[model samples]
Target: MIKTKRLLLRRVRKEDWKAIQRIWKDETVSPYAQYDNIKELDDLSVTNRIARWGREAEYYNHIFFAVCLQDEIIGYISCNRCVDAYEIGYCFHSKYHGQGYAKESVLGVIAYLLIKIQMEKIFILMVEYLNYSLDGRGKCMKIEHVAMYVNDMEKARDFFVKYLDGKSNDGYHNVKTDFRSYFISFDDGARLEIMNKPDMADDEKALNRTGLIHIAFSVGSKERVDELTHSLSADGFEVVSGPRTTGDGYYESCIIAIEGNQIEITI
Candidate 1:
């Protein structure tokens, strides 16, 4: 059990399913939840589902905590194992919204995971419609740049500038470390930093490798996607995938560009 000033977070019990069901039934909470058949689930089904969650906790370390206030279960926070980190998700009763209980409980749980469990990383999972700002001052946050290590920084910078219409700044160089980089900016305010350093390991980028696989840019239309894709292919860059509509409806093409990195041009 993890306790904060006004909240208690403990491993969920099967008996707590009624409170969890009540929270899930809330109009405000149900829409964002993954379980679509909460309304159709009978008491037996809900209990079985809760038992499965408990089993997952015991077997896989994927834990679901019942967030309680004054001895009442008000909501739940789930922490699922993802690679080396934990991905967390939460929901609460609508009446308890905006009370800071969720925030307090999340902090307590995070502290417990990091300090007591010796966890290295924790990720918060949110719904697609929700905008989570990392800025503590209540200001809007945006990605300033995405950076990557490259062998030939100039070749990488030229690839972006020539094909993708990226504008490059006068590159930076560190005398002590022999490090160099260039910041290539796009018209839509996105920036990419291509960097180089001595003795940097160049691992073979397997097609199914994890981590960042590609950087995608929207070119405004399907026609533009086709046009640019043909242009890149004509210029000898390998077109790894088509300028075709994907299963998820993305009209895009993937190309092996800039030191074996994949770049996706989309509409």
Candidate 2:
């Protein structure tokens, strides 16, 4: 069992099915549940489902837990094996909303997964309409720039400026170590910093390696993606993939940059 100052999280028991059904029946909580417009389950159905959840011994497949406070069940959280990653979902009674109980219970479950079960790479599926106020500090924050090193800075700068319409600043030159850089700003505030060691002994492009696989840019629509892909192909840039819907629901096309780096243009 995982205990916080005001909450306790433990394995869901058969007796807790009534509280679980109550939470699922709540209209407010039902909408945010794993399944949309989920129908309310009866005592027997809930019991069967609870039995199907199995135990920590069968955690290789799935697991579910009840979130409680003062011996009263308030909500439930679950983690299911999704291919290679664990996908987690949580639902709380509407009356308990805005109390940070969900966060505490999730953290406790994560601790159990990592420390006891020794599981890694948990994926939290979020609602599409929700925006995360990540730090809870009421401060606006965003990605300023993504930086990378290239063999040919001028060629890379020209490719982005000419094709991607990225505005370039006066290139920066450092004499101490002969490092050089250029900042390419897009229509949005986001910028890309391309840098290189001008006087380095070894200058070879690293492709199909471990770090920094690709950089993706979101376009206006699918039409824009097609247009950009055609333009890049016509300009002799390698179009690796098509302007098609990806398995992850992205309408995108992949192209190789001047320095052999993969760039994804998506809608």
Pick the lDDT winner.
Answer: 1
Model 1 local distance difference test score? 0.79
Query: What RMSD value applies to candidate 2?
Result: 16.8
Candidate 2, position 173, lDDT: 92
* Segments in model 1 whose C-alpha atoms lie over 4 Å from true places: 1-134
Q: Tens digits of per-residue lDDT for model 2 on 1-267?
A: 788778888777666777877887784444444333334266765665565443342334456788898978899888865444577988888788788998888988888778877887799876632335334664334576899888899999998888776779999999998899999976535689999995555545465678778889865456668999999999898888888887866678899876778999975
Residue-wise C-alpha lDDT for candidate 1, range 145-242, written one tens digit per residue: 89999988888989998887787999999999999999997753678999999999999997679999999986645666889999999989999999
Q: For model 1, which pairs clash?
A: none
lDDT of 2 at 192: 95
